[model samples]
Target: MLSQLQKKLLNDFQQDFPLSPAPYADIAKTLGVSEQEVLSALQELKQLDFISRIGPVFPPNSLGNSMLVAMSVPEEQLQTVAEIINQFQEVNHNYHRENRFNLWFVLIGNNQNHLHAVISEIESETGFPAMRLPMIANYFINLGFELDWND
Candidate 1:
């Protein structure tokens, strides 16, 4: 069951999250709760699988260099390769797709050179060549949506 505080937290702050040093504290102030309460609720939400992550979404190519990489890993080695790829902090997230390029992920770095070096390292470590699909056009996708607590 979800508490009213948790419902409000989920419904209220999808966009325009605080960017200050004490973001949670700022949220607490806005919600009229203690900072610790907000943090504990978020942790509980994660443990209950209500939320996967809490972070900012930046515009493409606005912060730093990034690339979309795909790999065709053998079905038997899919999980293992995904684990190895996750070991890199540069990797944002990876998912398995139904296409021939079964595994895809986004890698971010300080510059193009850094991005290439990380890609090289990933290719070497996984023993599979990565197909780099650089961004040719920018598209805005709004990731935030209202959660239906009634569901």
Candidate 2:
């Protein structure tokens, strides 16, 4: 169950995240809570997987390139493969799926070449071929949710 504070924190400030000297503190004041309270709630939300991350959402084509890459991994080797994939700073998101390309991740870079290099490195380092699925078109959506989870 989501706490009132957690729900508020997730829905109220999805976008226009604080870009000030003390962003979390700013949110604390706005939410009538202490800085530590806001920080704690945010941390809890992340730990609970209610949110992937609380960070900047860069404009597509502005921060180089990104792709939805996936690779097949034997069940016994999934953890090891995931660990190697997570080592790259370019990897913003990684997850396990129930498909042949079971280990999935999103890779971001400053350019197409840089993006490919990261992919190449992952393949070389992990010895698993990654299928790159770059976006041909994107329809922007409000990723934020307005939940009615009774607290």
Best by lDDT: 1
**Residue pairs clashing, model 2:** 64-110
Models 1 onward score TM values of 0.69, 0.66
Best by TM-score: 1
Q: What is the lDDT of residue 78 in candidate 1?
A: 99
Off by over 4 Å in 2: 1-9, 15-56
Residue 96 Cα positional deviation in candidate 2, in Å, after optimal superposition: 0.8
Error of 1 at 41 (Å): 5.0
lDDT, model 1, position 85:
97
- CA RMSD of each candidate after superposition: 3.8, 4.2
Our tally of clashes for model 2 stands at 1
